[model samples]
Target: MKTRIVRVLVTDDHPIVLDGVTLALQNTPWLQVAGYARSGREAITAVERLKPDVVLLDLRLPDMLGPEVVQALRAQDSAVKIILFTAYPDHAALDAALAAGAHGAVVKDTERDDLVDAIRRVMAGERVLCINAAGSSGAALSRKLREHGLTRREYDILRRVAMGETNPEIAVALGLTRNTVKTYLQRTLEKLGARNRVEALSRASQLGIL
Candidate 1:
């Protein structure tokens, strides 16, 4: 049997941008454009009505910030996957979206294939970052690392942790013993004042470290 198509709800303040996105996804057999919204309120309402599998969210909605929309969506249904679509591509915007529970970020100028890949990756349960947009400045991320007081090794370990690696897996990847990996994670948690790995990752992403 064929797999079910991924239903998508798109929101953008600009009519032309919305039209362009709709047109680009029109021919993808695995995706369906379920609805479109021009504002955050409309986006919320449409998302509730459509129960789409994924949301293509514009960062600058006329009525609300993109992060607010993401939070609202998560508050309504945590399972709804959100992909932030933005023209700015700034680190702060990318960090905010991820911190607000966005599954992916795609620049407005991204190639059609890249955007589609982001949607696909998010649907597959992977966090997608548009490196071109996300990597412009290490300043914000570095500052976050400093704030977290994470050593270079701990930073590497946390990145692997956020990617869902097991301690043994991380140890193997980093060429360290499992016990050593666990110790690093413990130190990382204490430095960041995080209660757990999840909280640490969340804090790191917010600080743009992840």
Candidate 2:
């Protein structure tokens, strides 16, 4: 039987990382670098256009964060496997991305062989989270998100607010009523112990909940 090639769209801002990853993927006979995207929007667009089998996404895109990109991509195509390819594996952002429905994560400096293995495993219906050196601190980050007690909707609202989206805009984007968006925002603020949106964002940032 012929080996099937997995098409992968890699999204990262740094040219050097992009080039290196692309080269690494190219070295594998069964993996194809379907396309490259430097920002979250471009990744979404490329996924829509190319319909790649897998997406290797950077956690910090110029436009959107890792979790946001994961949510957006999953919204568009539930079948496409997403892996958060980030340098900050110990950060709360990785936890958020996994919660947002990525297949898993692989640290940016992961071995090329292990990266390939991870992609293959994900394709084979396994979740792969590769945070080798993060140790117990990564577990602590996951705990922090849960301890905040922010529902997914509330977290979504908080992130939107951080992006400067008005309630009406958030409502439209989330497909919720304006009042519903306000309610979620209020819940988020209360959870963060803030009197207002700005303070909420500040506190969330300080707590690494953002």
Candidate 3:
């Protein structure tokens, strides 16, 4: 039987890293390097134009963070799988990216075999997360979100709140009405058992949900 090919669009700012990843995937029988992108916007555009099966995305891009890019991609194409490829040293950032909707993550220094395995695993309907050795469990963030009954939108609003964005500002940024933003905020406060935004933020921070 012939192995199925998984076309992947790689997004990274570094030309050298892009070339290296393309070369590595080129040697893999079941994988195809569909295209390349140098920034978050470019990645989004490439995915729309190429409609690749998978996206090997960098955690940090010039125009947006990994999580933002992941969210954008997911919004555009729910069927396309995404794997965050990063050398970023922060575990929290990785968790955030995963929570935003990535199928998996592979550290940049991982061997080609490992990277290929991760992609295959994701294609097989499994979530793969192989980051730095010191990183915590890949599902930790998502687990917490589930346990808290926090929806992604609520979490996003909470994050904006943490960044000191008010309801009107969040509404503008998220394209929601002011009333809707207020309702989401009120629900979030109730979930966190806080009387106000400040207390809610404190509780979320203590729980490491921020």
> TM-score winner among the candidates?
2
lDDT of 3: 0.83
CA lDDT of each prediction against the hidden true structure: 0.80, 0.84, 0.83
User: Could you tell me which 10 consecutive residues in candidate 1 have the lowest summed lDDT?
Assistant: 136-145
Off by over 4 Å in 2: 133-138, 142-207
Model 1, position 186, has a per-residue lDDT of: 96
lDDT of residue 105 for candidate 2: 86
lDDT of 2: 0.84
Off by over 4 Å in 3: 89-91, 134-210
8-34 in candidate 2: lDDT tens per residue? 999999999989998888989999999
The residue-level lDDT of candidate 1 at 154 comes to 89
Q: Tell me the tens digit of each residue's lDDT in model 1 across 1-210.
A: 997899999999898998998888988888889999999889889988889999999876656555667888887778999998887665444565576689988888888788888999999999987756476534555565676677778877876676557999999998999999999999989887899988887776556565
What pairs collide in candidate 3?
Answer: none
Stretches off by above 4 angstroms in model 1 are: 137-210
Better of 2 and 3 by TM-score: 2
Each candidate: RMSD to true structure?
8.8, 5.0, 7.6
